[model samples]
Target: MTGTDEGRLHTAVLVGPEGEHRRHRKARQKAATRIESTARDARKAQAKARRDAEQAERRNTTYLPSAGESGPAALRTPGRLRLPKHQDTSATLAGQYPFLAEGGLGSSGVFVGQDLYSGGSFVYDPWVLYQQGLITAPNVVLAGIVGSGKSSLAKSLYTRSLPFGRRVYVPGDPKGEHTAVAEAVGGKAIVLGHGLSNRLNPLDEGHRPSTVSDVEWAMQVASRRRDLIGALAETVLDRALSPLEHTAIDLALRDAVRSAEVPILPMVVDRILAPNPADDEDGRLAEDGRLVGHALRRLVAGDLQGLFDGPSTVRFDPSLPMVSLDLSRVAENSTLLSVLMTCSSAWMESALSDPNGGQRWVIYDEAWRLMAYPALLRRMDAQWRMSRHFGIANMLIFHKLSDLDNVGDQGSAMRALASSLLANAETRIVYRQEADQLGSTAAALGLTGTEQKLLPGLGTGQGLWRIKDRSFVVQHQLHPAELAAFDTTTRMTEIARKISDLDVPSGISNDQEES
Candidate 1:
């Protein structure tokens, strides 16, 4: 039974299996066709992309003029040959009037945003203009209002002078701005007055009284009483009275002091007033009585001894970089004292006549007052006269242009004189100034248009420096301590302390303490 049933089922099963196998083969064929279609599509796409790229390359490689010809040779064609109307004119103009390129290196040895040029000629680097050696020495007028930092520029120059081994001298006033510089540079500060003699121990470490000549000169300059100064000069000069017979009076006086016993001023005065028994009708004495009287007065009076003796008013060391003379206390005295001391120092330095290529810098802080003294003007002139020979440089600092106006009818003359002094300087540094004042002074100094425009806008410690052929505007930087030390109150306190340390007599101590 099972064989018969199995035979029938087997036959049916074989038929079903054959049917399933045929269906499976059809499905495999359909899948193979779809795979071939996908590959064909991909190959077609790749061929199309390559053809498009080649076509684009061909198009790019081909260049044609608008007239439809190829290359520069096609320019000769009529349509392509049209020239611009102003081509020749533009070419000619270009040849004659060249364009100035901006943003390039300037002649001043600095790179600025733009190179200044006039008709193809370069102006200068703004920084180099300020650094040029034009306004470095004495007589160069610094005109600016308070807070303009004109004084700071002066101080910066003084500081720079130290590295060069330059000697700087400043007068001490209560403000003592310059006096601080002297102390910083290890120089002397001289404070003189009635009780100052006692309070300032001439025997102290670095203390000494000023020379008799120095004292007289100080009296002449600092004496508010012009009559007193006039009398002093007359008395001092009278012993050698011949108008044409000029003597080396300073030298002669110095010599007399070396040999004398009494105070020099009194002896000089007495000799001048003494009637010359040998003189005849003519004012001239037969045997040079003026010389003898001068000698005798210098010898008898303590003039030379007073100057060279203990308690020197001015203590100086050539090795020290700078010397500051405090004259703030000398306000009771004439402004003339400052002038005399300054002039005398310059004269003495010149007299020493050492020329070993070392440079000496003498700075006058608050130089405005110096203009009042003719002797100072003369000394300034003398500095100019001797600068080239001695390498001595003078820097005169002032608050405003008006400070130089005290020269009276010779105002213009004085201006010219000052200008000459400025011209001799190798560098001119100008900081912020009042617009009107800066404009005028810049014009006078021959600053260019760019410099004139930029000067008033300069920031603190920023300035214009001019040397021989170059000019530049630069921002000067200083140490924080230096800035703090220069403050007015700080400076005054320092000078007061220095004076107190002098250890003069009680009276002098009291006077200094009061100061």
Candidate 2:
């Protein structure tokens, strides 16, 4: 072993050590990779096990009716299988008709309760029921005191209902609650007032100015009140006859107007009421003069101008998603008339003309006032008569059932009419009310004890909801903007801008135009 032999041996030892170190590194890397892959596989298996367990739990929890269960279950099965008494039949029943526990507002499709027992057990979910088309053609009646948040609840309902593409028409003078809702939903608001009318120039717009003929047609459709018509006719005869008459009188007045080629109303007055010297000897003229004179006098004085002027009277275009008739400036009765005339006419035309068959919802905030008019009564009757075919819904709001009674005998008729309307509504909402009136209105609608109990405790924006055949109460939460949108000023500038575009004539001035 010389010096060269010792160096070679040391080099061999170093090379051997290097080879062992390389083999160890490779084995460690392989082990680490195997561990990572095994960990991933374990995690996946754990997740799958958890999912399977959850599915099994759901299957076990879902309700299904037992052998002896009757009605819906019996109907579904032609033959029955006997089961032990301890088998928990109630769970099975609940599973079969989940809606029985949840109610109409629970699922998407319409749920027609099989029995009164099952129907009464239905719960309500406003959001779910509305989305499912289960509550189509809802006629919502909002009843509450002045500050009981009726308007707020109405706004919530309108906004929530708009996503379904239903045409929502709110009268112009909404207590300022629905304006924001209209805007938020991409709808239009037409503020009705003297300023709106004066600025819009409805007469020159060529939207077919409302004639006495239109008024007569509206009246004829509106009421069977012959006395009201007779009174109106006599009033027209005494002072000035606009060339319009009842359908019975249209031909005669039209012929006269055509022969003279003059606007009819003023001319009719001249012919009927201008004291005729030729008739003085007949004695018939003097005897019947008083009644005719009184009738004509009242007709001329009784705001007939609104009839002719109303069509051109500051109406919002139906093309807009929403139209608000800002009747804040108009007298209450006059406001009611204006809303009834405008909305009813627009609805009639839309129902007749629109081919796509869209549904339109007309919401009346202080609906009792419109119910007072025979014309409005007739319109509502027509709406009810035509609702299924025309896809129109009327959402009428009143403080109480008795508020409807304020309209006199007409009120009673309206109440009966309203009952029919509610029957057609499919969806009914009864919010918080005084303890006294609560029981009666609730009973009238056939609400159960549980429902009645729920009514008194309803919070703001909360109330009972009955969709189609089911009833339950819910607390509705509104978006902040929606709550604030009811501010009157939100759409004022836009409305003013629209009015400014109308070719309104400058010559006509109205005392009501002072704003």
Candidate 3:
């Protein structure tokens, strides 16, 4: 500043104290820049030393080329990866991939439950399956241990089908389980028993199909009546009828039909006991029918009287949504139960024979009791065989598959008839079964090892549905309303919560043994 300011002294005087402030600011920035240059020199020195060391290290190191190791130790192959294609049934392939499930019965028909394996909704309609050709038999065999929810499933199936314009018929409800369901669905329950005014004439001309001509109908009715009377007698006798007994029944039935416009069981019984002189020209006719006559007489004049001795007080309406024969009143009487079932079987036979009966559900609930009689069991086998021709679906419910063993002795005709009921049904729904029953049930239905193991672990409303050859583990869903309406344990449940010990019998189990 002394050499330069020599000529700038005059301007510095004009600049005053402000010029001195500017000079001091410039001096401070110059000092800071000097300090920064000193720090930058130190950094450059450190960088140069680092670069030299790195170059020395690089000279000592070895590396591979960009194309990778150039030797046999490269561990690389020239060929691309490949995999073989697999071919097998879905079921066999599912073993290779355990997460897979049954390609469910498609999204059509009734939504009965959820498919446990597929993680999708499960739908089942016997007729739908038949239409899809997945099953040729529209009949179903439902088996489960007592309180295993078979009853509820049966009810769900028929009730759900009502919306699709199908009808239901419970030929006999020994425990009256279907009575409420029948009533709830706007149908009639023909409740008949002792002390009740209700009566069912076995000879009542039942529903005549529109497709039948008068002559054809007459012949049909006559044949049905004759067969029904003989079947009733056989039921009461606990064995098949002889040729002579059959002849006497036919002759006596002819006499009754001629004598009364609408004949009753008593008329046939009286004619069989004391044959009309004109009809029984042979003196041996009365003796031939004595055993058969007395057996039927029990239905009209003995312990089984009052329900079928006169013209029917109730009519079997084919157009109704459902019809259930309530034999609970006489369930205690084996003879009476068989007689009622035999009579109702004829009623249903007439309805089923009609071409216009539409699609119907012929359910045999508590089938074990019905099969005890040879006549009813024979009719069941016939219905199961002819289910396709009749446009009707039949469901045979059992407490367990082993119940069929009680039908008759091994290799007996009755045993074969009972076995035929299951043989014709392709849809077998199995709920929770007892440990002892798993073997027979699995063998009878051809369940897979996994399916057999699944039975014991099934919760309520869970069932293994084997429709034809395919299988699904279904969890049946119900609406709050459907659940409340379908509940069968109301009696036991009500007896628990409200009534005091002194007012009720204490045998209530917290868990419902039957749904």
Best by TM-score: 3
In lDDT terms, how accurate is model 2? 0.53
Cα RMSDs, all models = 24.3, 24.1, 22.0
Candidate 1: which stretches are off by over 4 Å? Answer: 1-143, 160-164, 171-174, 198-263, 279-315, 336-352, 410-416, 489-515
Residue-level lDDT tens digits of model 3 in 24-78? 9999999999999999999999999999999999999988886677568767775
Question: For every model shown, what is its TM-score relative to the native structure?
Answer: 0.54, 0.54, 0.79
Top candidate, metric lDDT: 3
Question: Model 2: how far is 436 from its true place, Å?
Answer: 1.0
Per-residue lDDT of candidate 1, residues 378-477 (tens digit): 5566666676565565666666544444553554655666556556655555667767676566655687776777777877656665554456555555
Give the alpha carbon lDDT tens digit for every residue of 359-378 in model 2: 66677777775655544555
What are the Cα lDDT values of the candidates? 0.50, 0.53, 0.89
Candidate 1 or 2, higher lDDT?
2
Candidate 2 deviant stretches above 4 angstroms? 1-100, 103-137, 161-163, 171-188, 193-249, 252-316, 332-353, 404-407, 410-415, 487-515
Ranking by lDDT: 3, 2, 1
Count of backbone collisions within predicted model 1: 65
**TM-score ranking from best candidate downward:** 3, 2, 1
In candidate 2, residue 43 scores what lDDT?
A: 100
